[model samples]
Target: MVGLYAALELAPEDEIRLLNIPLKRQTEDIACELQVVKLRDNPKYIALSYTWGSPTSLNNEEGAEDISSKPSRLILCKAKSNSPAEPQPLWYRIMVTENLYTFLLKARDDESHALDFYWIDTICINQKDSEERTRQVNMMAAIYQSADIVHAWLGEEDKDTGMTFQLIRALASCCTGNERHKRIEGLKDITPKALGTRELTAKLGACADISNWKSMAMLFHRRYFTRAWTIQEITLAKKMLALCGSHTIDWEDIVKVSEFLTVTSWTRWISEVTGSHQANHAVPNILDANKTSGNILYSLIRSRRFMSGDPRDKVYALLGVAGDSVRGKSRLTPVYGKRSVAETYTLAAIQILEDSDDLLLLSCAEGDSFHTLPSLPSWVPDWSCSRALGLGVTGYRRYSAAATIPRTLEINESDRCLTVKGFRLDDIVSVGENKQDILSGKPFPNWLLIINAMPPIYYTGQSRFEVFWRTLITDTAGTPPCHPAPHSYRPAYVSWITSKLSACVNETAQQTGDSTFINALGALAATEIPGSPLSSNRPLSSHDNERPGDSKNSIDLDEYETTFSHARHLRLFLTSRRYLGVGSESLLEHDSIWIIPGSRVPLILREVNPSAFRVVGGAYVHGFMKGEALESNPLFRDITII
Candidate 1:
């Protein structure tokens, strides 16, 4: 562990020397390159970290002359992937191990058989150097992907009890269905020969078939999952239901998750463990809340990008592919005759996500305070989230201008909103006004911000009169009477569809009547209260707190430690570029401010004309009381405190 810590300290700026040879050449090379010898002649410390399999082979005396040249502290040990077996190896107790990428210390020099110490990989690898870490990351896929056994080290006694054990046991139990210890204890109830056969059978199955896939899956699940996942798990469950084409789950497990949700942290592990188990099962009868949470959890596991510590491009890819499948599934509903359940859950997911947006934003906001956790782009958060751009200019070319802006707006964060001044032909023409009068004045609501941008009519060159099936299985029926229309047939369809959606969505909101959204919105407002009045909300100003050593141009781990350490201390979630923005793959720096929840950023407004005023960015205003007085700053005067 000490060596690993030293490696962490030394690896940031220097390439590690593996010290593979019989002498101390690797260590000497490392010292020479770093100029530590010149800076502090005969530097006091030399720590030796070795692999467990190679411990006996290291001849400590071979490099005595080399070691004699410097004032040194030597700590040596071999790395072990798992606990030692009988003869007790070192101390009678088992040694603890961490994830493969990093190593942890498990024993001291006083212990026999065990070397003075062992260097855990993760701690030893210089995490600060993305270039160096990249090598480790690239190898991670194989490490976890092909591993035979993955062990989790739950910390000391009382701290190890309750949730920690529950989580560990839950994961392990997912594969074995019971603790190995208990299973072994129960074995005494049976004949020894029967147990031997059982063990043999298990081993054969594990090696030949997918006997232990669940455990591997669990390990991978924990490695990638970094936060509370009740919400994500629920989301995944719903998706799995869609995958299975069902709206039901095992009754027993659903009750378990429900129970967990209502309990305190001490018992919360019940929900966390069960949630993963149930999601793995893909139960549908689960509530929208639980389903959403499950889906998010599932996404993290099945997600290659997140697990491998890469950005969310793979997430986008996965979603895009799923969207295609969803469309296909929607089309197949009529034939398979499962439209009701599929549509029900689909609508449920939409409603649930919409309802939870505030909560999600709030959770993410609080977790990500000080801009540590990267957030999903505004569009990514809600697949159905849509915004319309308003074109304000009018009468440039009435008939021709209509071609410029479509009624439907597709999802894009940076340019979702529309503006009038800079763009050509902004407004719809008045029906009765003469060409001259129509051109004379701007419309009252010059900039129309479409609250719920309706989906565009899908076109594959079909005639307008042709009846194409839509996923809105609940709405369609015999054609309702319509006014004979020569001038606006298309406009009429667009308006009708939009009105139906708008009314239905609004109706659903009134029905459920949940206030979680408002609460989440309040949370979001808390984060922005700190920075709003100090400066303008421009994209560039986001990373104001980042130091000079850390910039967009370079990847530095010290910056990461500084930033995440602060975030972890503050109990806020920290994220990086993967959650937002485009460019290089790196975590978001401290100075990089994510003041507003991306989902709430309203894309259409961002595209407002570059000429009149560009909303470079924005934030919520809250925390302070409306009339409370405060010392004057550059942005506001007589600010009130909450």
Candidate 2:
């Protein structure tokens, strides 16, 4: 055993102990030793980030014991008396994981790497002490940041582990300076087919190789990426090194490769080329680490896939990286064992909303009709529920008039209820079942059938009626048609639905040999005379002659096929006033549509009581979209929801 020196003194309150790596391996009963020190002493050390391998597997290994069942005990170290006049040696006992012990022993024995002290959670913190564990977990961000270097241990290396690190290093080296910038830009513009081309393949080096891509993808599949604490551990480190058995790689190289692989269209290309056999689940999170900053709410929501033994730690573990303003507003003090997981999550939601002063968090809410956890309020998203659906609408214009609404949200902490001041736009008179498509397995059925199912609206003539279905299906459902310059600047909903459809149909007809579909579209356009009373009042042009099968024009069958395929997921619902809506397949009868204050799209709400409702999810109601509801004469009221 190493002798304890009495030259240094530590404060009684500073109970953190650092594991000291012996100079050489020992044949004694205790293979390693620990040195008790104060964190206030500013000791230089390395922090470890790793996943606790399954206890069953670990316990079965030689020299491994089930420490989880053992009670924690304190070791007392008596310093050797100076000149034989002082007392004997001090003794202390600390509990640590078998894997950590193995890592420390290896680091100590390796001549190339000399390690003195380490801050590992399992050994440093007294896990049996709830208060101490809470305090230590809360300080993880600082501990990792304060370390000289953070080491990520990805278990013992396998046959392909060295290949994974080598591949990442090669990729990082290739993507640098002026050449790298051009490659990234060129990759952005490259089509899916071009990914496998000789020119592109040579530029990306081994990364373009299907075998290397599979190995790299499998590397990320390691369990270290799925642990909740590892997010902050890697993010807060000033410098980090990833260790896989004997192989090592810089953390920045791993991050760079991850970012490169996550480019918008590249994921699909890689997944397809690789046959989707490799695990790419953790790639998104590695990318998110570089993008998300200081927004703890965003981090928490994004990290829902991460696993934690204690549910409360999901929120508590993230407090270290949360911004100062968010922390102040949330005022979450770590008190393990004092509150239930439900209470902790509910508190986090309330505090986040109060701090952000926006309802963007509500966008993460799960549909009440789908999966509901017992005892959880509908408004408070259950972070533990991994199956929550994503926000229905995208491309939210942040500066839009509807987004600027001044609404105050209040939380009833005791009852776990939410209150907000907003108007009731319309009551849901009827809701259609989720339409299913046989081809794509999506909920969106035929757009024409959806619109016709609604009550008849006033029209100038039968020709005008035919035009409505054609425009709404081909334009609103498929892709909005394109129009002349001045008309293109109209309200987003109107301009979007109108211009894209016309352009898609024209382009689709001019590129494909599907004369049957083109003739049907042309006949519908011809039925409506030039001077008909259309919503936009724009006359149908003479371009009907350019339909598919026209000798002079070429039709794009790809776009034509894509339009029908994409439109299959949308289902239409009608309110009592005949207001039309397009939303998810989960929509049920009597579900109300509401344009909540800060949300980008109107949400579907299910009535729980006379006036109280639970959030079903967000939706795209045709006329009510694009802030139109805010200008309408609806009775605004303060409503309480759970």
Candidate 3:
């Protein structure tokens, strides 16, 4: 007892007492029970020797209803074992609360190995409460900011003397016996104050030949990335690349990407090998083959498809083809631990094809009763093509316009629903055959959009569409809209006429003059189709005596219904946007797609592109819209085919 206090400071006037518990008793039964009993004695704080099962019992008290809910602190032991050289199994409950890590270790000098350590964070913290955890993260920087000294127990317990000497010798070949002893001396006196010199610490930690740099960086990245390495890591990795110099050819220009680095001597060493594994049926060592395969896959992602022609390319291609199988067998785990290479590739391809609007066009011939949408070329299969590209379907799939006949428009004033007079849309396609082979019963593969009464521009949020019509007398595909603002461009005048008629229809229903609606409809019909009979040659202003009931409120309904039908067919010949999912920049970036089989796949707003569709003939993706006629584009797209 006198030896224990010999080196430790003790207040001269204060009394010191020692109450050592019996070592032979089970740790949980006696030591832990005594800990609770002593804590209940109203002591300010307690330092418990965490022998064997003591940590488990103490951690259990964290959530126990019987214990005090006040902030209780425990002084944990940091000492290692005394005699046994080999690391043994141990158990101690650890808590990961806020940003503070707390753990209990046995404070014993025993050589025999009866107790084990348990390293668990959940059991140590009250994880059931989020507020408590958030409070913990906010406290981390403060608690660690002012520590005077920190210790590193590099030497294992019961190890032979001069162990650190042996470690230095094995690490560096040129080390002499004197230098080895000097290194050991350095380790013995290392302190937090000495490591406070940021420059010296970084150089010491970043010995490239040393594998332990990663471990050292891990200890510091969380704190230092926001502090020192915010500038350091980026600078260091950049310098490393510069040391290798640049190549005349870009990585994407390389053919046979796997061999381009190793077999060809066109460039210096570009990257350091982290680790490797072998591939199936590979002639090269499994480790080397795996390295090549990874390199090939990464190159393809960077759009270096031309460079990946080696045997390793075959492995990578097959990995894409048999994506799930390869993923199931691979050792790599995604950060989220769920996404696979196939899914990643599909997502990237979807991104590239959807960004450009030029790839979305197709030829369509419109007639009185039917329209035909032309087929996209081999390059235009949309999202489905990415999965089976250069294989399976050598040509694009085509879909003919599902013929629709215009019927008398019927109005129901009581309800907003408008009925297509004498026409049923049910038999538009041969259900069983088309459903099985062509349409696949997937709306994303069909080229028709059934829109409500709103103008497409108000719903799409595309600035160009809203500005197109005021300038062009002809309504061409991909033309801009009509607007008078600074950035505005005009669209076809006929579009304005149609919109005016639609507005009148809405106004008439809301108790406005029915004659106004009728006159607007007649004006639009007569202008768009010259020499057309509008059922009335006179404007509603002249027909002021006519009953408001006879004024056609249904006129706007018929116009919208016909326009929507034509737009549906036009989608088959044009590329439409499809939602890809939430983006990395979004607040809900990592939100998983809650998908059921045969249900619509949600797309991200920016990731929506026309090329994501695979249909027989032509298809496109449409940006998301509400069921109402006039609405804003939903941030995400609801994928509709065609």
Please tell me which predicted candidate would have the highest lDDT against the true structure. Answer: 2
lDDT of 3 by residue, 1-642 (tens): 122222222232221222222233434321211111111232222121111111111221111222222224332222233347845323232222221112222222232212322212122213443443323223222212211111111112222212222222222332224321232222322222233455434534433222332222121111211111111111111111100001112111111222222221111111112111110111111122232333322223222111111112212322332233334332221112244333433333333233322111111101111211122121112221111111011111211111121122222322321222111101111011111121111221121121111233332453222222211111212111111211211222233334444454554445544455355434534342211233344343321223223433212222222222112212111112222111111112211221111111111111124323212222121231112211332233223222
- Sort by TM-score, top down from the best: 2, 1, 3
- How many clashes (backbone atoms < 3 Å, residues ≥3 apart in a chain or on different chains) does model 1 have? 54
Whole-model lDDT values for every prediction: 0.23, 0.54, 0.22
Residue runs of model 1 more than 4 Å from their true location after superposition: 1-120, 123-130, 159-607, 610-642
lDDT of 2 by residue, 1-642 (tens): 123322323233544556555556344223334556666678888888876553222222222234443433332323323456655446545544555545655676776655567777775665666766766666677788778899988767778777678767766675555332233333333334454678657666555555665666656666566566777787788888988877899887776666555533344444455443222433433434533467777767666556565667677767777746444443476777778777777778888877775676665665654333567677766666432134212223322325567656778888888887666566666554342332222222233333444433323122333333332332232112221111111122232233333554565556674445644443343333232222334544443222223233221322233222332344456666656655545567687777667666676777788678887655655545456776655666677778
TM-score of each: 0.24, 0.69, 0.18
Model 1: per-residue Cα lDDT over 510-572, one tens digit each: 656763543333223222222222222534223223222232333122212111111111111
Q: Give the Cα error of residue 575 in candidate 3, in Å.
A: 22
Least accurate 10 contiguous residues by lDDT in model 1: 386-395
CA lDDT, candidate 1, residue 571: 11
